[model samples]
Target chain A: MRGFGVFTTIALLIAGCGGGGGHGDPNPVQPTSTPAPAVTATPIPTVNLVLQLSSSVGVAAASFSVGYEAGRGSFSGSGAQAQCQLGSSDTLAVNDDDAGTLKVAILPADPTRAQNLALPTTLTCSFDETGGTVTTAGLRIGDKKIGVIDGNGVVVAGDSSRLDVR
Target chain B: MLLVVAAVGHCARGAYAAGAPSCADPNGDGVDVIDAANVLRAAVGLPSTCASAPAACDLDGAGGIDREDALDVLRRAVGLAPTRDCLPHLQLTEVVHDLDLPLFVGAAPGDDTRLYVVEQTGHIRLVKDGTLAPTPFLDLSRTISSGGERGLLGLAFHPQYVATGRFFVNYTDTAGNTVIAEYRRAADPDVAEPTAARVFFTVTQPFANHNGGMLAFGPDGLLYIGLGDGGSGGDPMNNGQRLDTKLGKILRIDVDAYPTPPSGNVGGGDPDVWDFGLRNPFRFSFDRGTGDLYIADVGQDRFEEIDFEPRATGKRNYGWRITEGTHCFDPPSGCNLTGITLPVAEYGHDAGCAVIGGYVYRGARIPGFVGRYLYADFCSNRIWSFVRDGARLTSQVELTDDLDPTHALGGITSFGEDAAGELYVVDGPTGLVFRIDPE
Candidate 1:
């Protein structure tokens, strides 16, 4: 039953994926927070790492959480938005304070809007280098892994080539 | 929460691009958290962002997207039973017209294409493949008394109808007595062998008005019969409380053994009396999905009711003259309500007069209606539905507006469920039969 449901949902997603080619949003939406106390401090270097889903199959929905060493730096931006143009879709990014991770959920409001992302849909995460270096090994998707629903409602099992952070 | 609400409101006001699909997903992506959130907002009476794709949100087809729709979407997101199909809107599609005061509609077991309609003039007509057969399936007009609730009223095909070719009927004989008779199907599948009707049970009716002519086969394979309290106003004969008489009671008899009472019936009464104390149980049915019983008992003066009993519950005394729909009737002010089972749902005469019982929807065509009980009023051209959750009645929805928008199908005589469990409506006054279809 679970397999069938997954298949059905994926198949519906495929219907949403219309035209290919992703649309990039250079400007990222920022999260709001209280102003920190002003003081003379060393400039912290910011690193923008792009988490890309590079599979051939178009995705209508995707869910994954980004985890990193909190002591290294905080996620400078609010959340991730789709670079792929799926019309009338919503992406929800929530920061889990206890787990020290940012959970992102991308779904199309209308199924027909599901489309293939740019060759690599990039989710740029800005990291403030506090103590350790933010390397590809240090950055990882959460233990739940990345769940990408393709046009056929099948969960695209993420391999190194399909899902990557750089 | 505030941010989400604000985003949804903004989306609701956003104009749909030309040629865009009708759904809330602005990006035209598949259903995800955003759509579910929008549906949840609409369910709570807030504006739904699904203005663009409204059909995508109204999953169960009860008209207007609500909480259930939202829940269905959420369930789909998580891979649940209902996918993205919107609940089909209830529309009365005329299937057959020009019958002679049809009172009930049914279908033979294993027969999916034909509908058997019982005419009050004592002929069971067949509507096969959407066409009414010119010849009546069984004609008893000459054998039974016609007019005013007399004549042939109910029919039930045996579960093994294809094999045994046996069926049953409940009607008032020429002498005005309630008769449970068995008949066989002729060589032609659409015809009943009229000469072979073996009358197995007959109870004399004191008055013509409340004969309570409804017959059904229970899940236990026993023939259950409905009879009104000996007739007249207020059940003057007081037959409802008496078990010795089958009047005003639902009797369960083993037709296979010819009039023998099924074991575990009401103790010490007329051995076949399963339940007593009903004024006129005009219509009742056993849920095909759960085997539970639902009876639409016609009231005396004030209230009409829908009574329910879980499967296997025995000897329940539904208050009739003692109480008309949870209110004291016989003693007028304060009669003993103890030990008497009240109706699960009731409405006053202000709403409608005579409750016409219906079946619990177990049909595959309407996913939203599954498990919900649908019934109607004989006087008021209205149909209502509710889902019984344990002992509580919830999700009560009046479907008159959605189904009979013009009220042209006057006087809903009964609600019929075919072999597949899809329901139909019988209009006695208009001599019409309508299948409930998704609009």
Candidate 2:
């Protein structure tokens, strides 16, 4: 009876420490009658990105990643909101609807700048959804955190804080 | 950043916070929250400020502050933008006066070194050897009306001006009609025989306004004359569409041969008609390198248009009395869907009222915009450029404020080129001449 009492106290202490109800014991003694059917779920793909400055004037480089859901499908190209001078160049990329990636480089006119610095501190990559508008994710300069930007490349609310690179 | 936020927040609180479904600030004093927010964002270096709130910083009251506003402040602060685009840069250097009263401006073939200007009262002036000859080269003001759209409207030296020393002028007669006349340098080489006036072609003007009054020699050596639509508003006469009328059309003539010479006229020829359907073609020029022709036509009410005629095409009809500038007139008659030429560049009356044609910069000084065509406005005082790639024309920039705005060239009567291919502007109202140079 002494031994049984000691065993009972030990069991109680273990259960309490584990914080698990009787159904979820770390070392369950239950042996399933039949193996649970193989659980199969679609895995979300991860995006990789990098920012490179062609003309160096100490401008910060920014990067970002986007996530796709089951119904969201895939993304196409990406864009950056930049203060570019006349004849400054910027590069962008994104995942396409078919899971492929699209990339583009844009050089806009900026005749006013003496140094011709093109600072695209924020970037947004988006993908088209099946029934809804395009889903977008953004990245501030030198950070991997994704946010939201409008169609015109403006940072929306809740995403404004993430765009501060300076 | 704090200022921007405060301003935006204050605006949002004053306007949108009121909770009016359709808010109306009667005095238009309510600040736009979105705009304020954008200003803050831009000032803070957070993404783009203008991309979202374009109207918040509309400092010029033009409804939105896009690149123009940004550029405006930057230009005012920094003097001028770079002259890489079509807009002229601020004159960091000195503003020199090569010649005043540079009436008519013309350049010699293949050379920009020599500049020729016509004195409005008659007589051609030359800027050669870095000095303006004190005497008149040719005197025809006595024969010219010297009135509206009259006097010496155009001057064109033959491509072989070095050999022939021959040139032509487009002026209005005492009858206020369009005349293409020819003249030659006198034996003294410095003076012109006033009696040496030779009538090339005379087209009677129906009214005072749309005489078209620009004469240019194409690379093909065909003399092209621009005649305006018989004047009066809305093209009441519809002379532009009529093939029989020389008014409102470009007349291409072969002036090398004489059909029936005027009794005292030294040079006479049947001036064959070129492309038609022009309304007050104030100025026109041939691209020195490609021979492409550019014509600037003044609009009646709504728009000012620039027409491009490639050297290869003949008898092109620019839409006049029909579609003014990519838009149909109020009544919309005679603006046919077929067989009408369109302008390469156009602007609204609000931006500029009249079009002043200028030369394509073939000069070496402006390397970035060498192939681009430069033109100006009479009222808005704006100078603009159009870059042609093959047949496509892209607008480059507006350069009004970049120029000396203190001297608002009320009427941009003509553009002149020096012996070195540099260009000059003649303001009719001020009788002042400005030369375009590199900073």
DockQ of each: 0.04, 0.05
TM-score of the B chain in model 2?
Answer: 0.75
DockQ of 2: 0.05
Model 1 misplacement above 4 A: A1-166, B1-87
Say which candidate scores most in lDDT.
1
lDDT of each: 0.72, 0.54
Model 1 lDDT tens row, A1-166: 9899999866545544532223443433333344998999788887766665455544433455667787876666433321222222243334433235665544334433433233355556566667667865576675332334433333332333344433
The per-residue C-alpha lDDT of model 2 at residue A106 equals 23
DockQ for model 1?
0.04
Give the Å error, residue B310, model 2. 1.5
Q: Candidate 2 on A80-140: residue-level lDDT in tens?
A: 2222112234322222224332222221223222112255433334344443333323322
For model 2, state the Cα shift of residue B1 in Å. Answer: 40
Q: Cα miss at A148, model 2 (Å)?
A: 19
Lowest lDDT sum, 10 consecutive residues, model 1 chain B, at B1-10
The DockQ-based CAPRI class assigned to model 2 is incorrect
